[model samples]
Target: MITGYVIARKPMYDFSDVIIGRNSLLRIEDKYYHGIDRLNWIDVESRFKQSAIPENLLNVYTDLEASEQDLTGIKVLKKYDEAVVLMSLDEEMTLKNEILVIASNKLNQIKGHGIATVQTITWLGYDIVLLGGWSLIRHAIFENRQMSLLKVIALNSFGLLDNEEQADDFLKQYNKLADLDSVDPLLDNSSYGVDCIRVGVL
Candidate 1:
């Protein structure tokens, strides 16, 4: 896992695809390659499953805790004393971004001040959603906290194909590149082609 501490807050950048790609690179130890691959997704998922519910972090800030709040149009997938995990319930097939933000705000308000530090993670069921321009992975990275991790799972050739008919052709190209151990070149110097992308702040 890429580990680093937040020394100071940096100015938030304007929302853009490039910013998301850069943050995705920060999750890995490398800073040069702002791209991702299958192995990177596995690593990121492992980290999330391992650290999804922090056990010791709550103790560090005794004054901050969670409280009972009415959350409508959202489902609580995981509930813990220190954290409440939520998933979208809308039938529109996209995450209700405001619900997560509202939950975070409620958690912050529980402390009666701005002492609570809230972080969010979003998982997209369809790999094609990454190109939808509405995915929350980018917001989870730069907008939530100074240091954060963003993880996304994309399908094989999902990023390169323009339509379903091109799947076969793109898959062949991707496979050939993978065989040559030069898959990064197929990414077009971006993280979009990777099966998974992870950006984290420890």
Candidate 2:
């Protein structure tokens, strides 16, 4: 099974919306019963971009949030509660070669953040296609693509590395890539841990 994690800017909606009813119409009933509003991709993405603490974090923050909607039918095993550190897996395991990452807003907006600093690194072209952030996931899932990778990491967790020394050490171990030139910065790298997905061909 292809495995990866998503660090979302917001908590995932409970999976109930996708499973509670026998038919699509019934599902709509269930949604109304459960008070789950249908969330459009654009709505969700905008929410994250606006809620993100530092304005600059918008790039990565929106990227991860948008990816979640890409799957045809996705289930959320865990969700953010007043902000959380969580992981997600596709129940059908349909994704063949995709990697995804999901992170919370807290983690996305730190000043002098190495992850952000290295944003340029994501552009390096690699064997794998890097669709910029979450939008790619949405495209893949909507288009019914067979294999994709998503990388979602919570920015809040990285807050621990606020110290420059610690941040640098973390980058040395996690961000170093032999094929930095191969990754496409605009493509999504959330599937393989951000550090592992190279800029070159996958």
Candidate 3:
């Protein structure tokens, strides 16, 4: 199990009760700070630098109304609307994960060749990704759902921390060498209750 502080987070979606479904991505666009009608669904591919087209057509929508299509077959992975946190598992579990952090924009991004995506979707609107094998808590996010909250901020916005010293500091403290097979993340349950847990918007 992982034991860490959820130091920061951006807000979750304002998925309101609807009067219409004609367009639903407007709130999403707003969440990522997009201008009205300035967004293009086709632009998503380039923004995420994705070579393969997404399986779900609704993934790149630019509307203000939502439908069942928005879920893309992914069941919501966490309950109590548990806002995904920036989890840095304990050193005991770190040998497996090695504190690797990556940046991602795809909700369905795969954990390939010993890689795992970070639980947090956005940090001040930039995608937070991880690179390592999955622990039980981290794995649950993937096993229960096939989709991730798509990284919605603009491509240029990704530069927010790319050139800063803080980014380097974040990378240095988080990364570790590979040795993932030994740890059993299933045995840990520190995230559900408050030992070192704190959940809310940043």
Candidate 4:
């Protein structure tokens, strides 16, 4: 079992509820930040740049409505809702020596649980782009049900760190290595250029 903090950012769609449906991903959960979860530093013009996020607080702030104030980040949005998930992974379910993260826009679908044929639709390098305030890097697919939630934020967001110093410090302390070219036979398909996780029978 591999344990870590996963922060997910969904850029395109706004969902009312985020459901976890996979067994490979266990202990699906999230954290609540009272005063720290404010969208004070989010700006529309600041595209391609990382936003200011307080420590230990997942930055779920999305700049959907630029003029709206106190709009409850990820709580309620006129257009869409963004969220972050934290959970664990069962390595035995993954392709040996390969770590896969899935970011899907689906609000009620997940990868099918149990051993089956999992294919890699594409390769999203560690330096992933951040369209929304954050990114979810866990694996989502076309399936019916299961458990777990590992947040995978945008690579550019660097876990939504405030500055270069913090980002660099984060890189230095990080030690997990995922093979971008590995062939995983029992994983979910990863979609590119869009946040889409389809649920299909395996």
Can you write out model 1's per-residue Cα lDDT over 1-202, one digit (the tens) per residue?
Answer: 1111111111121123434425532232331221111121122123335664245443422222112132211112122222222111222211211221112222223223333223443321221112212222222222222121211222222221122343344345444544565432233432233222222221
Candidate 1 residue runs with Cα over 4 Å from true position: 1-85, 88-160, 184-202
Across 9-118, the per-residue lDDT of candidate 3 in tens digits comes to 11122121221453422233233221111111212223234543333432422121121133321111221112111122223222221111222223223211222333
**TM-score of each model, in listed order:** 0.21, 0.19, 0.17, 0.17
Superposed on all Cα atoms, model 1 deviates from the true structure by an RMSD in Å of 17.2
Model 1 CA lDDT for position 199: 22
lDDT of 4 by residue, 94-176 (tens): 21112223232322122212222233333232221122222222211111111121122222222122222332322222212
Q: What is the C-alpha RMSD of each candidate to the true structure, in Å?
A: 17.2, 17.4, 20.0, 20.4
- Candidate 2 C-alpha lDDT tens digits along 92-141: 11111112222223222221121322112112211111222322212221
Model 2: residues with Cα > 4 Å off, grouped in runs: 1-4, 8-13, 21-46, 49-53, 62-202
Rate residue 8 of model 2 by lDDT: 25
Decoy 2 TM-score against native: 0.19
Residue 184 error, candidate 1, Å = 9.7
Q: What's the distance in Å from true for residue 41, model 2?
A: 10
In angstroms, the error of model 4 at 21 is 2.2
Among the numbered candidates, top TM-score falls to 1
Report the number of backbone clashes for model 2: 64
